[model samples]
Target: MNKTFQYVSYLWDEQKAKSLGDDQVALLIYRSNILGADLRITNYGGGNTSCKTIEKDPLTGKDVEVMWVKGSGGDIGTLTKSGLAALYVDKLRALEGIYRGIAHEDEMVGLFNHCIYDLDSKAPSIDTPLHSFLPFKHIDHLHPDAAIAIAASKDGEKITAELFEGQIAWVPWQRPGFDLGLQLRNALDANPGIRGIMLGGHGLFTWGDTAYECYINSLEVIEKASAFLATNYGKKRPIFGGEKIKSLVGSQRKEQAARIAPLLRGLASSYSRMVGTFNDSDTVLQFINSHDLSKLAPMGTSCPDHFLRTKIAPLVLDIPASQDLSDLGAVKSHIEKLFADYRDGYKKYYETHKRHNSPALRDPNPVVILWPGVGMFSYAKDKQTSRVASEFYINAINVMRGAEAVSEYVSLPLQEAFDIEYWLLEEAKLQRMPKEKALSRKVALITGSAGGIGKAIADKLAEEGACVVLTDIDEDRLANARKDFGKDAAIAVKLDVLDNDTIGQAYKAACLAFGGVDIIVNCAGLAISKPLAETTEADWDLLNDVLVKGQFKVSQAGVSILRTQGLGGDIVNIVSKNALVSGPNNVGYGTAKAAQIHMSRLLAAELGPDKIRVNVVNPDAVIEGSKIWEGKWAEGRAKAYGVTVEELPAFYAKRTLLNEIISTKDIANGVLAFVGGLLGKSTGNILNVDGGVAAAFVR
Candidate 1:
């Protein structure tokens, strides 16, 4: 903590607010963005804000006071006016009277629904009651890490009071509900001059007559908390020494993570079908490498806000400091037992805290895993959730570190964690998420994904919600592709498919990035047209290396990992129509592709018993954006067809019965259909993506 607000990035504009109608709601959205822009203030959908405004009631035709609060599941960082739910203030206040006898969460949700002022508004946040009960015109509640550090300490209340000099009230941990709302109101009534309230084991709330005042109030409190933490904990360091864990430190650690991720993924799938995203970031590595990791990690999250995402505690994998991670079979057995024990412990925790009306026990698998030698692994239904959990854990580590520096770090009671985890309002967010796409929890590996058909196939897989590992010899192009697809959805690895070492490394990286591969699209190839008599040995070797042997190596690596996970998978080889139909002066290219097609058929037969489907997609004349159709190759192909280079595309399309121009996207669609199990029971089959080329048809 710098004395000043070093991290605040509020870019609020008065004219922009005026442009949006210059009302309390506009100001609310503006301030929310300001507060949400910094992860230190609020992380991914973790905070809420509200404003008291007047809106016309359709039923009574009169202006009535309404509370416009952040809607459920809305992230303030990207929130809009429509993301705020409007509720009748009077009706909401009346709920305090009737909500006393009702303890059921469903009943409370229904009552909150009945208080909605606008039918078209989104569902109000579960914390709406606290904002509604407050007397201020504007209110903001955030779970800033700095505030959580102080609020989650052993003597959190005392530390909070000393830090803010009693300018803020401290409320003990209470599950969010109507009763907690009343308690907040009572605290405000008792401490009328307090500018803010720090909710123990939860978050902070500040309010004022205007949105700017409340926003500034939140910033001031966070700054003071940051200062206190820096003064006390700035020099503290982890107890572990780098030399003591040399084998488990630096670059080798990532290799260890890669080896263990697939094993953990397999174990997790035993509980559910959720995918695990392995993160070996500097933050995670530092935390996991600490000698006190077992002690700190089991101590629960820094705040209860993370419970919904990361659960009460992380599952700690028992990887010995000097263990030989190279022995994968032994490592797998060790991790299996660790996972089983973790599940048992989780069951015990649930048994101790569960209530009569609690929802059925969630999958006992931990959302976050702490493997000492490796790094943190976050598991969820898909990549997005796993990334969110990873972020929360990283922030929690920082907060816990700060708290430990000052004093002993403590978390909320396990009971409170369970309450929030099972809360109907919290559960509603998961329920409201749109149905997962066909390939939502799948991971795909696409070679030569820097551009052309491989790039298109990678994009399509990501669009369908698959975590994609993009591999290409073109490092710059692969980096750009990763940036375009985002870090959460895509990972880039420089892979020369022809090299056995690179193929093996790429497979390991894919497993490390996203559990293991569910689909492998072999789209790496080169076009070399030469007559059988003139084709040099170099051309034959190049074609065979990239087209035939490369596919086999990649498939073998992927299949080994897939078999270890024991999950059914898909393998789609991007062969060519030339594989079936010969063209003059194309011996080298056609021979290699034909060999790959036959290899795919053999692989399909061999891997069928393991539930892995192998198929081929033959795409012809995909000229647009195809690197194969460049320079002398395109001119020569045009000359062969008795047409100019400009007419080559139209010439090929006319030769097909469909008379349609084929594209890389068309080939990508064929790969997607095969990998998506459109032909689940059909293997050793070829799907044509050549606009219905009669000669290439493989009936």
Candidate 2:
């Protein structure tokens, strides 16, 4: 009947638990999902949960106690049964007999594989020992911002003692490993009936005799810590002192962010190409515009999870927030200077602390960049990683806000941070990752992507690992077009190529969502079939406007973004076989196609110096899955050929040498053939996907 505390609440669904019945692991998963669902409780993949249960031993045909814990690289929020690693509880505890000290902590991680009770279990993580050595049956080790705020504060232990009054225990800073596990065990032994323990500058560890009880315990601890921070909220100016710079008003911040993101993206990708994500949320702006930003940012983050993802600290650009950043060249020059210094500082940091056996120096570029007024920009190998990196820094910002509001925010010391960053085990994990996709770091913008050949082209590029920007004049159609891709994969924008402003706006959206464009696809077009005598002025204008002018505007905008990124790019134009073959009732459409073909060749020649390749794809008789064939274009073409609409596929096929009908998917494969790395060195070439239309062949 009584709620435990304010600032956070419990979320135990009794009916949901009843449905799960007596399955312990299912209950554990239910609990983990609920805890990870709230950012106030934990962030994506920030924590691990485990529960001890009785399982039938596969080899011995006997029941034994086992521990099912979240495995490596798995997110608690989206975890499945396969993501759980089942280990022998008795075998895990037995490792203490041959236990080595802190220096040999990494060996403990290797030993976890030996304790695997299930042959199909996922690989164990470094936190395995921490969960196993604990005395309770169910444990929740979480990086909740509220609890970490107290844990990461300088006076954390004292603050926790005064608030919890021995109901919780505090252990000083230590990396998560075998030694930390032993320390957690010792603290629980000393405190007897204490419900939880706080790991200084790290996170919280709460346990219960059962799965549901463990969930409630974690909720209670986090809620109390949050309420305490709120009560201390009377210490006004909950920033790093106060605002030192004036943040840009309204949309100005994002406009500046959009313009500046590509420049920063290019700079960040110097060592290896990367995708970027930008954030200007109020929390980010507050930190960026604060007076103590310069002082506090350099201290870095305290949580190891934050430290690993963001590195030691971010490169904070100290521009007066109100200063006009519209001139990209000016902004680039200023940032270039700051970037060089940051690179030098990073190299110095590595050299200062690195041991002889440390792994080789990594890319000196910063993962996180703080822009006053413009907010935060984070870069990584791809969109999802870049996006998650930004979120981690935001988590750090919240941690800092709470800690600074109560006590000085303290980060992990430099030596400890370095040890974890370059550890041999961490290096091994990095080396074990799979090879990158052909277009892994590339971003593509495809026009007319609502359906048919345009949609097919977008899917092809995305399949090869490129982030896609789906644009079409029909906004409603664009929504359905983008439904299949995740936020990190594709974004839909209403773009009418006739309007140069809409063209510019779409490029801006791509730059904001995926750093910049690396591939431009001109697939948006229409067809008209009428004799010269029957063709009206409006028909001629419509064909040329949508085909000729549209390709120019879209390609021109794409070339600008590619130039800004300084990364070589590809532009694929989907022309028609009619561009080369002269057929009756195709005068306006054929002329527009011819212009598009020649323009590709001309632009290919001009843009070669910029490392931009332009290629043309000619698709013929692609009636299936094409929006163009759904209306007058198909009817008009059918009438001109003296055949019913249903007979067009066979009629067109009979005209070709191969007598094979083409589908929209075949056209998509043609686009992929051009953009995929197999043609990395070829450009200005036209490939015909028309089943051998000899008249349309290139001479």
Candidate 3:
């Protein structure tokens, strides 16, 4: 149960599972997590595992068997006890008596709820019957690329028979439901001593007497398939029948990817707004550059799990690496034409395969797109989904490679694929998905993001479901601030808005990280307080550079990307109340703030034609967490007001019309009001987050 092989790692620690003692469900979770850890075993959320145990029935006060399987939409790698669905084993068996036949198998799914052993258990998955009907105490069902490579080959059934030599049986593709579960039970009955089944055009199923045995059985089968594929793969010359168009160099590869990412993201979001993930690993490049890419790509993925993540097939752009990318006009035109054709093709596919009971046609856009030399692009509702979709396609590529090396690769027949895609059950699961966040699929970039107000805005946007780019001149704080956000939610860049190169580089990073930016919060600034008599040339230049010039360059950069996406966007500038109020000892800082205010109005007027909204938030006397208040500005302001620095918060509050102290979060909320689709219609306007000093009120 705990032996290692040259192919797959044996991750099960005997002490770990044994430590659980009598907790059989905990043991299953331990086994499932280890198996799901390896991509060679299964892609994210692609596999499920189960165990059966005897527990006293609350009503009968007698010991009864209960089957615990992974719950609907749960990921094995991250599964918890709450994520497993528990049903009475005997109740599951009783359903067979009422089951009409294969035609009525779907109705059995509804019947599964009646078999619940515990009222609080998670909702059952469709594969419940397969695990319940099986005689084994422990079972693992997985869609490992290595095994699917063998299962999806043209001679898969023949090869499975020859390789395992009666140790394993083959089950032709069948939709996972009560009917397939019955078939699995029948297979076990016929094979007598067989350990597992190679599910044709799908995946593998392995069973054992216990959790440890089941874990080992799953690994052993996958390892053998992997070793066989590796050996056959090396013997075969020039994988995928040699390379066609060469892969672009690393620099050119990323350059091209970043350049086309926005356009492609916009095109892919035709059906609905979607986030995108790009991958250019060596594995991806090899497949993308292969000679048989054109021939094999259109054949699509074989595994149902892969098909669900990726669409019927990826849209392959035949642009060679040698093609000129300097002028994007021609490239854009060609891309548009291909997109039109792809939509038409997808509609026809739906028309040809749809049945009377089929669910309505969903998004016709391709989930994946193959750009040779540029890498793979996958789109979905959010970053994680897009990233997971990309991983699934890479698994599909591995499946295609192994199948072609050993035997001709074959995808699931289109009819079978349509049946699963349009299945009412699948549609129901889709309907059950949680509603997306207001800012979901939108990406935001905030300058001085490591600073107080900037960080607040960054966190707020990310919380509202937008991917965020945190840019700051403070390298240490920038790095540390990003730690608070999830990997899929944020990226940090050390950007100095004074430098045009850094300004452009930040946008490039933002595009590469999250496809492109939809919200730009210009919050980078430093304050200076100097009387006319004491103000120096250097003071004037510094305030102008960081405040007025900095915001201008950053806003200019963000607008370029937003325009390219052709999607209306929001630009929120964090200015100061000093711009509207005339105060002693604030000549330089106030002038810079005035410039920022007018500039926002200018840009808002110009960019309105492009459907881009530019607004401003003016904050005043914010002492806590303000980088400006940490230096000479606070000392000067305190000296000017004849009050101690410690009393600044109270002093600012007392002067306000409402006598309220504004925090960094308050400023963040002001920015959100503009970009969060609340006050989205109003632009070239200002929202004051200050305590409402009468002198600063706009007339």
lDDT on C-alpha atoms for all candidate structures: 0.82, 0.88, 0.88
Off by over 4 Å in 3: none
Minimum summed lDDT over a 10-residue window in model 3 is located at 321-330
What does the lDDT come to for candidate 2? 0.88
For each candidate in turn, give its C-alpha RMSD to the true structure in angstroms: 2.9, 1.7, 1.5
Best by lDDT: 3
In model 3, residue pairs whose N, Cα or C atoms come closer than 3 Å (at least 3 residues apart or on different chains), thus clashing, are none
State the TM-score for model 2: 0.97
What is the C-alpha lDDT profile of model 1 across 1-699, one tens digit per residue?
122466455555657766777478888988898788888898888889999988889988999999999988898988898898999999999987767453653467667888898787888777888888998899989998888877788888998888778889999977777777888899999988999999887789988888777877788788778777777753555332221243356567777677767777778887666677777777677677776676778878857668779988898876675567565787777777877898899899889988886777889988898876567888888888888888898889878877787767887777777777876666667778898888888999999899999999999989888989999998998888787787578889999987888887888888777778889999988888766787899999999999999999899988987887777789999999999997888888989999999999999999999999999999999887678888877876776677899998888889999899998889888988887756778789999889888888787
Instruction: Give one digit per residue, the lDDT tens place, for model 3 in 549-663.
Output: 9998899878877877788799999999999999889999999999999999999999998899999999987677878898788889988999988888899899899899999
Give the distance in Å from residue 400's predicted Cα in candidate 3 to where it truly belongs. Answer: 0.4
Error of 1 at 686 (Å): 1.4
Model 2: per-residue lDDT, tens digit, 489-575? 999999999999899899889888888888899999888788899999999999999999999989987887788888788999999
